[model samples]
Target: MYTNWDDLRLFLAVAREETLSGAGKVLRLDPATVGRRMQRLEAALQATLFAKSPQGYSLTDAGAALLSRAETAERAMRSAIAELPDTTDRLTGQIRIGAPDGSANYLLPQVCAAISDDNPDLDIQIVALPRVFNLSRREADMAIAVSAPTAGRLVVQKITEYHLHLAASEAYLAAHPPIQSASDLKHHRLVGYIPDMIFDRELDYLGDLGITRVPLASNSVSVQINWIRQGGGVGVAHDFSIPAMPGVRRILIDQISLTRAFYLIRHTDDQRNPRLSRFAQALSTGLRAEVARLEGLA
Candidate 1:
């Protein structure tokens, strides 16, 4: 009878990772179990496959030759693994992406570049959000969310931390109560995105500040910016977001700095898709860098 495939597979990961612990992470097994499986594979083959080193496990000559064959088998098995991340089977398709207007719209250009770079054939449908897109229902193929954990058991990757500050146009700040401290903002005319537009659960954390949400609500970030610039009100804005805009003025950077996490939520069901995986990685990477750029960290 042929040797079991699982042991060989575990051995391959150990050889590639160069540590039993690292291999266990790839295989989702305990380190001892990985060691036991490697032993079993070696015993079955009656060959010493690895020379364990202080730095890591290195494959002996026999293991090195076997590694190439194992990799081939692994790729073949991946092709047969029921689902793979790459759009290997299907060439062209659309990916529906739902995101918030504030940062998402600003960073869309950069994200488009990454997507175009990697998945030129895959079309991206940008959905504006006031409500969370239900990924379990496939409302969007993926989402850039400021969302909380949901009951559906979805996979959410935190991409970056978006920090908020109380800002106004120079004209607006000049006309409002002295915002030198948190207490002084009590009477400022604050422009804000419609409370409904904030889809993140942590947004409610803003309530802890006791700073009232300005009644002059607009659903669009541009409209809110225009209102603030025209001396309509002081508003909560991302510090990074406003540095590039010509007219917005920060009032209380220290007193108003509140940070929230931005997440990219993907379905656990589609986690194995090569195209989606690549797309997600590129999106996350671009977003992390773009946010740093926006914050002047770049």
Candidate 2:
């Protein structure tokens, strides 16, 4: 049976995006056009590819089986396109990065900005969520994660080790009892991640400190940091982020220090694509230097 590569390409987009509107945006086509194309593709194959619902399009069993084959074909096409002499040396495509809000807010803005400055045509999107990203679904082209995922066809690169320390606004410390040690944290209002919402054990900052109470808690790292900036409470803060918030000071750095590493994750198949390889190299190098520079100020 002969199948159009364009139809297969559209199938991959709809599968990855899980919505005709989203696929439309990516392909620069209207939703109605995308829907019609999907219908035509399904009809030509004489098989239902997606189960439609208000939530969006979900792949049926046959669609799941076809996804791997479609991805293989996609990678082959990318490799062929990369070999063409007409290809530009500069990266010029949209690449979405999924990351925890802390890095997304404090780290990526500068790192990605420098990259974009060098390659003006490159479009970078950062999806800041406080949970793990599903790369298999193509939610992002790459992701920065606190921990390496053990079970996925992924390429994981350790970016750098970053530090965090107990911190509070200078005003809060002046108004509250002096914190001489970890024990003193019990006497103060603590800000941290919501107990039940802690996505990763690495994010359980307060629990590691053996503190049970969090009077001010949020699922977002930015929210927790903002609360600390406003004198809401003492909480663990990223060392790199401290220089940006003037009044926030790290407390008991000698006694209360936490270290974590960031890992750059990409789909295994994408390792063959030269564009992504160059971008990944630039991102990793920039993140290491940026982390060192910022932590020096902290």
User: Distance (Å) between predicted and true CA of 192, model 1?
Assistant: 2.2
Q: After superposition, how far is residue 294 of candidate 2 from its true place, in Å?
A: 0.8
Q: For residues 1-298, could you state the per-residue lDDT of candidate 2 as single tens digits?
A: 6358898888988999999999987688998998999889888888899999999999999899888888888778867865556467788978899999999999999999999999999999999999999887677889999999999989999999999999999999999999998888878999999999998888998899788789999999999999999999999999999998999999999998999999999988787778888899999999999999999999
What global local distance difference test value does model 2 have?
A: 0.91
- Model 1 lDDT tens row, 184-239: 76667667756666555565433556744667777666677677767787776766
TM-score of candidate 2 to 2 decimals:
0.92
Best by lDDT: 2
Each model's lDDT comes to 0.72, 0.91
What overall lDDT, based on C-alpha atoms, would model 1 receive against the true structure?
A: 0.72
TM-score of 1: 0.65
Off by over 4 Å in 2: 22-29, 82-89
